[model samples]
Target: MDKHNYKSYRIEAENICVDYHGKVALYDANLRLKAGQICGLVGMNGAGKTTFFNALTGFVNISKGKIRINGESLRIAQKYQAIAYVPQSEGIDSQFPVSVWDVVMMGRYGSMNILRSPRESDIQAVKDAIDRVDLMELSSTPIGNLSGGQRKRTFLARAIAQRASILLLDEPFAGVDIRTEKLISELFIQFKNEGKTILLSTHDMIHVREFCDLVLLINKTVVAYGETSEVFTPENITSTFGGMSPDVLLGPES
Candidate 1:
């Protein structure tokens, strides 16, 4: 596809396919996401949620197809730090012994000098991100020691500090409490209003129905995608999850 075709979209994936050692993960996945939109990437387990996110982050190789971010190659955008990725918190090493401040500060490293030192702006950015997530009081505490919710906020702050044009979040709200969920949702909405693009993968039907503007359902491939109000129905949900009840996706809708 031509680069000009990506002008109207914040991110675009055209026929993207990824495989690990010949085992297909994602096949011919196509999506175009615009700014100020929160897209929910939904599917059952091992159905390519994380694989799709990895494709966006350029962390995995694409056997075929193209991905453009900010109208540039994914690697170029990544090199300039135009994208931020917050992987599943459960996959993180909570015992890494880094403080909340330390974790957030790393986001600024991309803008630092050869020594990777922090300047006033970097410090201020980290501080602002931490404060925005309401982690100001625990800024000095070790991330490994925080509750599950706090840890999620800590990584989210890191992503915020980058001030990227797009954010790829993997199950960020999983295992979080109401307070944390509220804070995260608020931030997501705030960013969306600011014309930032956010795509998160999750099984949280509540979040999907309540917050997402767009929904992309994938069962190892693109099944359905459109406005959340339109494509997020039970029929599409069951089809995407291979006949599984939508309730089973997140334990019977309250």
Candidate 2:
């Protein structure tokens, strides 16, 4: 695709509504995330951050509204193939008997036919992703033996191997150390420079301010969505977090 054409790889949600058992998790949320932007999702627990991501990634059925990717409206099933999601590491069973290599290759399964084995290119992609995340030394290690940061990097490598235009991450920085967090932050910037779109949910306002270009504040609905600087003000954050001040949440540096 032409560079100009590729720039249109944006995500548009029109009045998105998600409900569970008659309870609204997301209500009439509408937002447009442009290509190559890293959008940070912020809201209190139970305020619908994960719910919005689930609806956007098609993990849950939306009660009402529509989503368009690159100008084409798509159903939930179709959206799955169009985006890559790296859910929280806690969701993975650390005891699962899988090697780092095996875990990363799962990302390629979506592109393969049923009952087919990985081809040479798939193997190479997995290797490249591992190397990108500086996991070559641990590539053969079992996932159960890896540290929390290593496990997070392993999943990030998997997402990179998927090569999707849109990436969704939930709490990626949760258990990571400062160095690993910096590495992941740099990787996100690299993805952005390569024209990929990213939406990540995080509670750390500091990282949100430092890493994300855009911010999506949700409190059962979209309280604000725009450039990080504009949407992360004390007023908007207070609207979503309730009783919290931006200075206290973001700290002095932010």
Candidate 3:
């Protein structure tokens, strides 16, 4: 793990590019996020949102550029400790036998030394995370049997337990109801208030505008990035999505 004593940008990626085989997925992407900000990662389908997250999380090797957390250069091996990722719900295996508590505990497992049991602090963290997500009653439930919202909350609990300063969430509200969406949004707010830097991918512009302090608009590359009010305009949306329906982009008011 490379280290740099740089100053306080919580998350930064500079001139990032990723290649899948010989095909380019992202190009020259640069993003910097401060602590305590909820930034929305929004783009059309197949627009490399997931690819960018993968690159940031070290799941995919970046062909060029650097990612840093709290001023330290991020290495693939250090990604687990530096970031916690909540992937899309469909990615969760319905047939997996793990209980919710077990899944949440796995988050803390990375921070524990190898061959050593979890410390009291780790156990407490897991419990607090579970309670924070309002899943204490369902903690012992098999993850497979939980509802879509419950599953989403379970994974969120896992991320909270990881206690990483930076969280990368991919389509966290995809399958849940509006009520559940509101609940998750509140959790993000709480995390932001606590000074966690969060980057979440979502298709809902309404939610993006409502909760995100900053927004990154991308389509295989960065189209725009800045305060939500500035970057999420119809013009930028059109540019990013290749003229998506005005009705869809602007809603009824436009």
Task: State TM-scores per candidate.
Answer: 0.95, 0.92, 0.93
Q: What digit string (tens of lDDT, one per residue) describes model 2 on residues 42-138?
A: 8999998888888877789888998777666556435355688888977779999999999999888888779659999999999999999999999
- Over 131-208, each residue of candidate 1 has an lDDT whose tens digit, in order, gives 999999999999878999999998899999999989999998888988999899899888988889999998878888
Q: What is the C-alpha lDDT of each candidate?
A: 0.90, 0.86, 0.87
Spell out the clash pairs found in candidate 3. none
Q: How far in Å is the alpha carbon of 47 misplaced in model 2?
A: 1.2
- Number of colliding residue pairs in each model: 0, 0, 0
lDDT (C-alpha) at residue 4 in model 2: 51
Query: Worst ten-residue run, lDDT, model 2?
Result: 72-81
For model 3, the local distance difference test gives 0.87
**lDDT of candidate 3 at residue 43, scale 0 to 100:** 91
lDDT of 3 by residue, 45-80 (tens): 889999998988888999999887788767743655
**Which window of ten consecutive residues has the lowest lDDT sum in model 1?**
245-254
Question: Which is superior by lDDT, 2 or 3?
Answer: 3
